[model samples]
Structures are given as structure tokens and as C-alpha cells.
Target: MRQPALITFAVLCLPFLLHSVAARAQPEPQSTGSDSDIAITDFSKPSSPGRTFAARTVINAPVQKLCGILLDYPEYPAFMPNTDNASVIQAADDFAIVNMTLKLPLGKIKKYRLRLEPRNTPQTCHLSWKQVPWEDLKADDTIADTSGYWHLVPHPANPARTVVDYFVYADPGYVPFGFRWIVDILSKESLPKTLESLRARAAELP
Candidate 1:
């Protein structure tokens, strides 16, 4: 009788122990953490062939507000860091072709055309863009290739706030030996500033 009682007690406690272990293994919740915190993962290292960087941050604004700011491509230069000019070349309801000029370090400028698409679901809003070649426009210099996406979803613990995920990769092809840092900055260092700019812009909204 005593042995059977001990075995039953051990079985009862096993479930709770397993549950605690699983909960500890889960990722930290953004809502419960600092709102100003930005998490970045760099995958552009030589060992990682992906050549991309990913970042995550929590914004105080809702997804709808952020969506409006992102979809307004023509106004990007006003708020987007390093953007010198942006214009909509062609547009449809769901997609648009936009030409952007970026002011890089040391007076370097890159002009590129991008095709952007907006997507909305019940739970998330997504904006994705990739570089596209344009024949009719003249540019001082064009970047080799660039692509990225922004994912905005309602916070699980707070629907009024948003969780943002940024993914991007850029290839500035054939840089001088002295200017190699430019590639590093474009692919990695500039991520935090880009995300922070969007957060600040959304906060300015009414």
C-alpha cells in the first residue's frame, strides 16, 4: 500500500514538472519585455550562406497604423533614414513599382527600382519588396540586388500593440577594397536604425 501511494504521487508531479520545463524553453514574450528592445540576428557571416539579416521589435502602435505608414511609398523619403527620394513609377491596388534613391556613406548614392506588394490577413499585415530593373530611367549608380519584407502582427498579449519582424539582404557589388565596410553596414548595421525610424514615425501618428 505504501509503495503504490508513492508511485501515484510521483506520477502526479511528473506532468507539472514537464509543463514547467516546456514553458522555460519558449521564447521571451515581447509584450512582457521592454518596448524599446530590438532583437537582431545576423546571418551574413561566411559560415551562413544566406547573406541576410533579421530583426524583431515591438511597436506601441497597432498594425493598422504601421500599415498605413509602410504603404505610403511616396512619403518614404520624409521618414525613412538615408532615403533621398522615392517616387511611385506604377501602381495597382495590391502592388506598386517605386524608384528610390539612397544616400550611402561617403557621398555614395544608389538608385534602384523596387516592386512592392502589400498583404493583409486577419492576424497579420505584410509588406514585401524586391529590386527590379527599369529601362526608361537613368541613374548615377544602381545596387546589384536587394530584397526585404516587413511583417506586422498584433501582439499576442496586447492586441493594441504590434510585433514587427524585418528581413533584408542587399548586395552592393564590386566595392573598392577600402570601402568593404559599406557592405557590412548596408546588410547589418543599418537594421536597427531602419526599424527605429518606423517606430518613431508610427508614434507621431494621431
Candidate 2:
């Protein structure tokens, strides 16, 4: 009778012990997206003279496929509603100079030439850009100067999912005080739409 009672007590404690162990062993859930695992370093600050905004998303596509779409300048105008036109003037060694016109909400268009650099790694592709100063409007009438980077990082567990990290900086110029509001709205809204468009276009790819 004593042995049976001891055995029953042991069995009851086993589950509780195992559960505690399991709870301790479980890891925390991480951010999932295009650059999910990659560590991001932010150089922008509110105190800095330039204003910066950043956004990210997890794209349900491979990194290679995403990179291809990003570099597809000519087709951008057709699939990306915000883009009025895009043309690549030069390309060499994973870098290209592209001229693009973005449609603003006020029925105006803003054009800029961006120098794109692509970094190809085993599991990721990073793209960064700087505005060509010459392409920027004359300082007297300019509203803002913009620059940013995009990262396509592959998910470790799922090869089909890629995380996209995007950062944009805007330096609102002197003349148009109202332009600041437009820039702020565009910074928040435009990038997510662009990512959605990229996903749609990738799914349609043959």
C-alpha cells in the first residue's frame, strides 16, 4: 500500500515538472518579415537637421524574386500607381542610376534621380539610394530632399517569406510650410502601398 501511494505521487509530480521545464525552454517570438533577423542601425534622430521615417513589411516571396522586382525600373510605371515614370540611365556592377517621377496627392509630380546600389549576400539583398543633387530642384523652390535604403532579408525557417526594411529621410526646404504636411503623409502612407504593389506584382510573375 505504501509503495503504490509513492508511485502515484511521483506520477502526479512528473507532469508539473515537465511543464515547468517546457515553459522555461520555449523561446520568445521574433519579428517576422523581409529583414526579420537582420539587425538594423538607425542613424536618424529628431534632433538632427534632417527628418527621417522608416517602415517595414514581411513579403510572402523569395529574396531573389523581390530584388528582381525592385530593380525592374521600366515596368514600375505600369504596376506602381504612384510612379508616373521610371527609366534607368546607366547600370554597372549591381548599381544603376534611375530617374523617376512620383505622383503627389495634390495633382503634382515630383521627379528625382536616384543612384541605386545592390548588395548581394547569401541570404539577403540590400538596396540603398542617394538623390542626385543635380536632379534636385533649385534650392529656392525645393520642398524636401529625400534618401533611403531597402533590405530584402530571407526568413530562416521559411524560404518563401522575405522581410523588407525601408528607411526614408526628408529635409523639408524653406518656401512651402504646407509641404511639410504632405511629406509627412506621404512618408507614412506611400511605402506600405509600394510594398503591397510589389507583392501583387510578384504573385503575378510567371
Candidate 3:
């Protein structure tokens, strides 16, 4: 009887162990743990092959308020830092195609177009995107590739608050091999400021 219960317990715990292993295998960038407001993490290594980041914040605003901010695709540069321009090429109630030009720290301009899909529920919305080849440049001309999602989850206990999460992966295409460190440094240095700016902007919204 004892042996059977022990085996059953072990079997029940396997999935959790696997989850911990997987999380450790792809360790998120280290950061100060969050309390209730905002926390951010970004992978920044001089020799790393790609850039990835995730940010989480609590905003004292409703989901629809942030939904409007995100879907106003053409005005992204007005509030999103380092973005020089954004244009919505096609649009619908639930999706859009957008083009963006990014002014890199080294001053190279990278342009890419992406498809965005918005999924909304009663109190939450998720906006996700992936890069697509555009006419002005080949797939290799801009940053190599990118994909990400922004999720707004209403706080379970606080009806007036929402938890916002942004996750992104970016690969630089035209970046010079020797100077990739510049990109790494900039990504790390800029992410916190970007999150702060977003928090400030959202807080200002009605």
C-alpha cells in the first residue's frame, strides 16, 4: 500500500519537475522581482545570437483603455520610444497590417511590416505580431525577424487593475558582426526606460 501511494505521488509530481527544468533551461533574464506595479527582463549577452525581452506591469486602468492605445496603430511612435514611424497598411475590427521604421542606436534605419491579430474577451485582450516580407526590402534587409505578444490580464483581486505583459523576440539582420555588442548593450539599457514610459502613458490615460 505504501509503495503504491509513493509511486502515485511521484507520477503526479513529474510534470511539475519537467516544468521547472524547462524554465531553468531557458532562464529568463534576471531582474528585481515585481510586487504590484512593473517588472522587466531582457536577454542581453554580447555573444548571444538574438534579442528577447518580457515586461509585466500593473496599470490602474481597464482593458479597453489599453486596447484602444494598442489598436491605434498609426500613432505608435507618438508614445513608443525609438520608433520613428508606424503606418497601418490594412485594418479591420480584429486585425491589422502595420509597417514600422526603427531608428537603431547606430543610426541605421530598419523597416519591417508585420501582421497583428487582436483577441479580446470580456475583460482581457492580447495583441500578437509576426514580421512579414515587404516590397521595399527583402527579408534580409531589415532586422532579420521578430515576433511578440502583448497580453492584458485583469487582476483577479483588483477589479480596477490590469496586469500587462509584453514579450518579444528580435533578430538583427544587418548588424555588423563585431559591433553586435552595441545592440546588446542598448537593448538592456533601453528596456527599463521603455517600460517606464509605457506605465506613465497608461497612467495618464482616462
Candidate 4:
């Protein structure tokens, strides 16, 4: 009777012992590791101009390098998805004005001007842009209004990595009938693609 009871107890404890060992062998997660980059897109929040869109990711490159790539407005068409042309009309140490033309879904062309500012601190780098009026370009012909910012921070666990956050508020005033899908494409679907584009661009650079 004693032998049978001891065998039953051993069998019950074996699984728990194995699980404890497995847990102990597992490695601790890095603070800002690529595994923690979990991409998230939220459009549930309502805003005055358009729906709010926010997404985040981790890039393998350092923050400084990514900041440089973002400030290079003229090179946007080469890597930025749906961008047809980007012309910087004004440039200065603190800000830049860029005219961007985009080829949207169904072959529609949208053109707008944006005033971009790059802000930097010891801990983070940020690039914010808002649509501005161009005398020749009418509001009705282009996007109603748009504003967004990209925030970059260095990874705490790794010096060579960066965490990036992207936020967008866009109001495409009047989308042609049956082309309402463009709104979703711009906000929801494009978020991850935007991160991927930036990551690829950084990898391509020396």
C-alpha cells in the first residue's frame, strides 16, 4: 500500500517539476526587443477632421539613422509607398516645406503641401507634419486636412535599435462614390506597410 501511494505522488509531481525547469530555462525578454515590437493599429477613436490612426513598431536601425532618412523628403518617392513625387520648396535648419504628390488606389492623383519640423532631444527624435495651403492648389482638389507625427526612441536594452511610433489624423473630405475604400487603405492597411518601408529603406543604406 505504501509503495503504490508513493508512485502516485511521484507521477503527480513530475509534470510540475518539468514545467518549473522549463520556466527557469527560458530567457528574460528585452525591454525594447524586436519581439516586443508588436504592431498595433487603432481606428476606434473619433476625431473632428478624420478618424485617429496610431501604430507602433521596432526598427533594427538606430534612431539617428532613421531620423535622417525621414528628413530626406526628396528621396521619398523611391521608397515611400504610393508616393509619386516630393518637392521641397523651402528648407531650413528647423523646418521644411514639401509638396507631395501621391498616386492613390484606382489611379487617382492627390497633391498637397506640408510643413515638416524635426524635433530632437537627448532621449527621443520626432518629426511632425501638417498640411498647409499652397496658393495654386485648391483645398477641394486635394485632401481636406492631415497631420501626423513620427516619434523615435532608442531601445534601452540595445543601443543599435529604435522604437518608432506613427500617428495620423486625416480627413479626405469627399471621396468619389464607390472609392471609400481609399480611407481604409490610407489609415488601417497602410500603417504596417509604412513601417516596413522605413525598415527596408534603412537596411538599404550604407
Deviation (Å) of 71 in candidate 2: 1.1
Using alpha carbons, what is the TM-score of model 4?
0.78
How much does candidate 2 score in TM-score?
0.70
lDDT for 84 (candidate 2): 82
lDDT of 2 at 172: 46
Which residue pairs show collisions in model 3? none
lDDT of 3 at 104: 67
Please give the TM-score that candidate 3 achieves against the real structure: 0.75
What lDDT score belongs to each candidate, Candidate 1 first?
Answer: 0.83, 0.71, 0.74, 0.82
Question: What clash count does candidate 3 reach?
Answer: 0
Q: Candidate 3 local accuracy as lDDT?
A: 0.74
User: Model 2 misses residue 205 by how many Å?
Assistant: 1.8
lDDT (0-100) at residue 3 of candidate 3? 95
Query: Per-residue CA lDDT of candidate 2, range 1-206, in tens?
Result: 69999999999999999999998773222344534333333345768656665666677889999888887778998778578888988999878898877776767566677788988887888888887755446554333567878777886678889877777776645536566655544455565566778878988996
Worst 10 residues of 1 by lDDT: 26-35
Which is superior by TM-score, 2 or 4? Answer: 4
The positional error of residue 107 in candidate 4, measured at the CA in angstroms, is: 1.5
- Number of colliding residue pairs in model 2: 5
State the weakest 10-residue window (summed lDDT) of model 4. Answer: 26-35
